[model samples]
Structures are given as C-alpha cells and as structure tokens.
Target: MWTGNFWKQAAERAVKTFAQASLALLTGDGMGVLDVNWGDVASVGALAAIASLLTSIVTSTVGEPNDPSAVRRTNP
Candidate 1:
C-alpha cells in the first residue's frame, strides 16, 4: 500500500464508489432526481469511499505489491 500505484488504484476505487452511491441515492424508491438529500448522499458516498480504501488495504498484500487491484503477482 505504500506504492504510488496502490494509492492511485485506491483513489480510483473510492471515486467510482462515491459516484455509484450518489446515483443510487438519487434514484431511490419514490424519489425524483431533484428530491435528493445532498447531505445524505454525501455521507453515504464518504462511507463507501472509506470502505473501498479499507478493502484496498486488506487486499493489497495478496496481489501485486504495487497494484492494489491486481489479482496475482506477475513474474516479471
């Protein structure tokens, strides 16, 4: 997790999670896009981002040392 690549992957995951969470909230049951509670969306997004970061940390040791999303270490 100390490598720059790992951090970049973590950041990307967090941003994607935040965007998805915001969209889910905006489209929730009986709610129009304009009816979104911005504060709630932000809170959920932040929590999702933090979870993504923690997942990245926990999985980092199992993959490529420098790449958080890698499924296996390369033999280069």
Candidate 2:
C-alpha cells in the first residue's frame, strides 16, 4: 500500500534522478545539455532505477507513521 507521502517522495525522487542523469550528459558529451543518446535505454533504465528507489523507500517507511500496513498486519 502507498501513502500520500510515498507518492510525494517518489515524484520528487524521479524528478531529481532525471535531472541529475540528464545533466551528466553535459559533462560526458560536452553538449552543455542532455545529449540525444540520453534518450536511449540508459535513460529508461535510470527511470526504472528511480522507481525502484521510491518503492524501497516507501517499503522501509511502512510501519512507521500511521503506516497503512497496520490494519492488514492486525487482520492477517
């Protein structure tokens, strides 16, 4: 289950990840911006990595706040 905070964190992480990875092209390609090749598989992989990080963060965060898992854990 996902809390509102989880989505919020994921959104922020994805944006930051995209920006950082895209900026990396500037240094590597001397393009001063995201290079065209960045639109390739590596970019998609980076996005997936970002999503994974979000999921992990949210999973670890579970059972902390009002942790939506509380109800399920008690019932099961």
lDDT digits (tens) for residues 1-76 of candidate 2: 3577755655666666666665665455665333356555367648765765656565644655533222235554
Show model 2 residue runs off by greater than 4 Å: 32-35, 41-76
Write candidate 1's Cα lDDT for 1-76 as tens digits.
8878789889999999999987788776468767767899999999999998888899888877776674985578
Reference-based TM-score of each model:
0.84, 0.49
In angstroms, the error of model 1 at 16 is: 0.2
* Residue-level lDDT for 2 in candidate 2: 52
- Local distance difference test scores for all models: 0.84, 0.56
Off by over 4 Å in 1: 73-76
Clashes of 2: 0
For model 2, which pairs clash?
A: none
Using TM-score as the measure, which candidate wins? 1
Evaluate residue 23 in candidate 2 and report its C-alpha lDDT on the 0 to 100 scale: 60
